[model samples]
Target: MAPAGPDHGGSGTPEPDTGTQRRLARRLVALQSAHEFAEEIVLWPAVLRHCPAGDALVTTALEQERQLKRTLEELAHISPGSQEFTQCVNTLAGLNRTHLTYEENQVWPRLQDGLTARDTVRLARQWSGARRRAPTRPHPRLAARPVVLGTVGLAVAVVDRTRDGLTAR
Candidate 1:
């Protein structure tokens, strides 16, 4: 059920026409949306400040994220019980794998190298805070910045979470 990102962990196999599969899909979407929003708001900003050539690295990462969101949008439209849904899930997993590889290999090391232990710890705290307040749904149209995120992002997040609550009920 986990989507690959800071909060990402183990994977799940799709079960046809099962309640578990539906819940898994929903959970994956929510977790990934939150994780990426946090990274864009906090982690990527640190990357821009710390890493040499940070702009290029963040650009590449965002492109990858944009693709992932697009695919997720596709996945949302498919029937979870169908073969197409399984294929979409696999496709998403592949995209997430590539994204994780890039972040783990490139972006993370640079960010770590740039920060002292204390600053790194501070950034982690900020990122965790952002993650907790992040939107539960993907809003691919918005720009990722602390200022914009501090206002419109939080507002949209509240709305999204409210909708998520309604949907869950």
Candidate 2:
């Protein structure tokens, strides 16, 4: 669970090769982007509809996500072997930890109180499906338009997965 909290002192390579660092960075970007998109498509809407302060909560979370996506986009362009890439990774990790903390603390509690148990379960399934099919690449520009995101997600995801290949797995 996102609200489980952050791993402040996580493990890392003291000196990873360019290939290893690049792969790790891409994997992180892919997973995080997919996770955020899932939230955008399913979780955020539920929050907006059910939670009392859903609007405010969603706004904050989305801002955090926007920052993360921009960082991920920058990371995608940097040379994997350079010092800048390592710094970008660190920056991205820090931002992610902060975002997770917000979700875990403020967002999750509201959600738990706002929705029924059955709703949560159903939302979970939807969120999982969204994650499975969401774009693997960061689309920072789309973060501001929740309506379009909900509608065009499938199309954007198809294009992203096509770029990823016939099958992302």
Candidate 3:
């Protein structure tokens, strides 16, 4: 999670690519989106099935994720000198921090209770694999399912990687 303070260089502002701030923002968003996508695909189902109450929590979390994506998109378009951009960056950082802590506190324990040691390891591997192929940018319009994500993700990953290469990101 990003530190919830002044932009320690990852604000996704319209800064020059030569600087580390823009690159750091991209990397942070990429990793965050990848992990969240993995959890949505691999973890939520088991949680919903084994722990009935988890459905609501997962749903809320997913909505928050969508909002986060929208905020990111806004950030991408925002000028570096704009106050709105600064606020958006701070907001994104706070949301990420809160979501992660909430997941660790409320969701992790329930998932642990539902999954066995072997299941945990298996799911961990699956999660890792998903993250490897997941898109760096958010696709809020896409419904995040295993089949849809696995199929569309490949194409998106290709495009993202291509863009990353061109931009030297």
Candidate 4:
């Protein structure tokens, strides 16, 4: 993810503050979590039901997401001013970029192959709803299961949004 700040004149200079890094990290986690959670709840099931190679594809994506989630949680403990924190963030950016590209290039096609225009539209709506209701922080345990993802995710989203409102985040 692009670190939050002014777009320096393509000089490749990073924002020189921990606060910005922290905010960027949190934002990335929230976005990635929402996207992954939506896939887990909506697209993956459809993939398995329709695509011949769905199991393998979804498994790889799941592993990537699991690793990314773990790394994201670890980021919360790192001092963003440190070199290690920068390295970790860079790693996450690369991983997230790769995952997104793969989803678009591979998983999306498979998911869309059998879907009608109306079905696609419906799925899009559901996906957006899922993202909106998804938690803004890592919850690996709750995220592991579908039942918990639906019920607990809703609860956590409420709490998270409330906290965000109070914190002005």
- C-alpha lDDT of all candidate models, in order: 0.85, 0.85, 0.75, 0.79
Q: What TM-score number comes out for model 2? A: 0.85
Ranking by TM-score: 1, 2, 4, 3
lDDT of 3 by residue, 91-135 (tens): 999888888887888888888888889988988898888788777
In candidate 3, residue 55 scores what lDDT?
Answer: 81
Model 2 per-residue lDDT tens digits across residues 1-169: 2323234333543445788777788788889889989988899899998899799999998999899999999998899978898799899989989999999999999888989989989999999998998888899988545578766877898888898776543
Error of 1 at 53 (Å): 0.4
Judge candidate 2 at residue 18 and give its lDDT. Answer: 82
RMSD in Å for all candidates:
8.9, 9.1, 7.6, 6.1
Q: How close is candidate 4 to the true structure, as a TM-score?
A: 0.82
Residue ranges of candidate 2 with Cα displaced over 4 Å: 1-15, 143-146, 166-169
**TM-score winner among the candidates?**
1
Q: Better model by TM-score, 1 or 3? A: 1
Hey, what RMSD does candidate 4 come out at? 6.1
- Model 1 regions more than 4 Å off: 1-15
How well does candidate 3 match the true structure in TM-score terms? Answer: 0.81
lDDT of 4 by residue, 1-169 (tens): 6654458445566567878878887787778777778777777777777778988988888888887877787786788788889888888888888888988998888878878899889888888888888777766666555677788777887887788789887
Candidate 3 steric clashes? 0
Query: Model 4 scores what on Cα lDDT?
Result: 0.79
For model 3 the local lDDT of residue 83 reads 70
